[model samples]
Target: MADAAPRLLELAEHALSTPFPLRLRAWDGSEAGPSGAPVLVVRGRRALRRLMWRPGELGLARAWVAGDLDVDGDLYEALDLLSGLFWERGADGSGAGRAETLRDLAAMLRDPATYRLLRSGLALAGPGLPPPPPHEEARRRTGIAHTRRRDKAAVAHHYDVGNDFYELVLGPSMVYSCALWPEPGTTLEQAQYAKLDLVCRKLGLREGRRLLDVGCGWGSMVLHAAEHYGVQATGITLSVEQAAYARKRIADAGLADRIEIRVQDYRDVRDGPYDAISSIGMAEHVGSDRYLEYARTLHALLKPGGRLLNHQIGRRPVRDEQAYRIDEFIDRYVFPDGELAPIGATVSRLEEAGFEVRDVEALREHYARTLRAWVGNLEDRWDDAAAVTTEGRARVWRLYMAASAVSFERNRIGVNQVLAVRAEAGGGSGMPATRSAWLS
Candidate 1:
């Protein structure tokens, strides 16, 4: 069966040459697969070879967990390619596809024997698998924290990684929020700038106007608004590290006079009566129960006829909890105390807070692209990143990339940019109709 390796390589070549065009390297003495492809196969030890041959999603996941399989190209692209093979045709009694794969995986998860076997394999193969950290540890540690302690822990655990690590992956803008991809072929940096501009345009920002950025990270959006749009911007963040970095960045940009970063809670943002407000990637911290309070706080902060743009992650309305293990995983490892409310819920709360919802754009696919870029960046700088953060952090980011790719691809999670207007008292006709009126 020496020819079996050749046959497998041939099959993989065929699959890769198809629409997927996967780049992978087989370390075995298999025929040096396709030529000029990004995928590479390096000769490795016997244990690595055995780990690579294992079938199904669990096997791939385990291989990743054990660091047995490493994709030199884009991890997201690799995931996209592997997603096609997640369910093999004729593997189950039914035909191969998503349905069959999920069915098989579900069955495996449910069966006691299968569960024990998988668990045992994981115990033996996986390295440094520790019990999940207590959820509220961060909140208990940081007194006067608004969000749940577990939630804060999750956010801190994820974001508190060194700033330089995020800088390498996120580029010069350091905008970790979703990008607004205006058109195909848009570079990640261009899309990010466009997203910031889009927010400024939507909010009717103008020179001499005061703008408040709630939960601002590293002052990217606010600084952009101040520099390019001619607005004075103030940013508030819960992260001390982020605030310090943002202050330095503002000073470096010569905008320390025009832009300020405050290490304060969103609830405590008082230097307002601002002309416009933006909360980019911040609403997730407000929790599902506190969304109303969040909306009300924005309403109180804005001046009459001012606009507010809330960019956030949203969950679709669904009763199916079984398919959402990723959410639980995110809560435990990534975000901890975070909760995603459905888009409808967010709109309802906004309306209840007496704001006029002007527009809601679901940038779900754009977020997929954004995350794909981030995962690609992570993979490209994995070694440097590993040096900057803890091993647990690396594992968490790996899982986050894989699960987030699935979530975005399947539309289980969404990114929404909601634009609302704070109606003038006594309610005359709302803000102007022309874009130039705002921009000029």
Candidate 2:
């Protein structure tokens, strides 16, 4: 009997005091907002109650995961529009930071219209207790943040979501890290190959040399290094599934003799004096508190003059580092307990661990393109992926990757390859006068 969509939009806009720029379609088929805008579809009353309970990012994430909320139009365009209002760093005046948002909420509570908004929301939500979080949400949270046990759980939550699922999303290469595109039209597989080759080159991997790949996801790095560079490689990862998958891939490629895949923690690694060590896309999981230990562990495991290529994700530094917080959705559902540091801080920590920081190359744009490609893969095979994993799990990956693409495109975060070497006692870093030797 009620046309709920228009009233819902009116209440939301009045409550936030900012215009709702997109379309909203209610469960009863009533629609609101501009004619051509992306549509936010509310499939059930549960979506509103979930948002009412948690208010910000996590609430929306839960709704989206539970399938109570969905977008009927372009996902990226909808997310880009919403990011300015709910997320973003508030630097460009399109978004508000926590302090500003809190002030705005306080101001809204004082407004008489907010009472009407609250009543409308309650009537729509029509409630029982908020629906339980989706089964796909990350659960285990017993041990210390980055301790071995907890770290394993965290890695498993994100990576052990079925290798078939990742294969569909990551393509044939199966490299989860950012790819290096030589040019715009490069295929994802080609870019990924280029990225692996670049790291091997930077570390100067050669025949008969030992290379250790810390946090080697699915064994892409080790396989590439051994096959192309003629190196004996060992790859370590916390995910059992990843290790198994990598081993199978190595066997299929006939490179098992040249590469070893182990499901072992980096701290437990004892085989030392490796000529090259690569920690690609893994350092973000090393909590800031344990970063020094991480760096030192790799340093101690490397031969003097051995190169450590830390291909990691970096975040933009803020004025007050102490107050910094990881994204709630990312912490709760995606990479649990993961943290990012500015490239400057990462380089400093490596240097403190007796590494001479050699090169810090930011590949921010490349990551945007890589993420976009991954998103395309997932979108193209959405049905098959959801069948492999739960729909909620697939949704989480889609949302995170799409948002991350926007984040990288806008420079909110970045990916960098920090090439550092354990300088020999004489202070020589293996004597490469110019990058020309490795650029090829």
**Best model per TM-score:** 2
Tens-digit lDDT track for model 1 on 359-434?
A: 8888998888888788778778888877887554665577676667666877767989998888887974276665
Off by over 4 Å in 1: 1-154, 320-326, 433-440
TM-score of each: 0.71, 0.95
* Candidate 2, superposed: residue stretches over 4 Å from native: 88-110
Poorest lDDT segment (10 consecutive residues) of candidate 1: 131-140
Please report, as a residue range, the 10-residue window in candidate 2 with the lowest summed lDDT: 90-99
Q: Write the per-residue lDDT of candidate 2 for residues 1-440, one digit (tens) a residue.
A: 65789888987676555888789999999999989999999898899889777777778899999999999999888888887666544333333454244236566577777766777788888978978888878895875799999999899999988999999999999999999999878999999999999998899988999999999999899999988889999999999999999999999999988999888999999989899999999999999999999999999999988999999999887766776766778988899999989899999999999999878899999999999999999999999999999899999999999999988887888999999999888999984878886555
Model 2 TM-score is 0.95
Q: Tell me which residue pairs clash in candidate 1.
A: 23-39, 24-39, 25-40, 25-41, 26-41, 89-96, 135-150, 136-149, 136-150, 151-337
lDDT of 1: 0.69
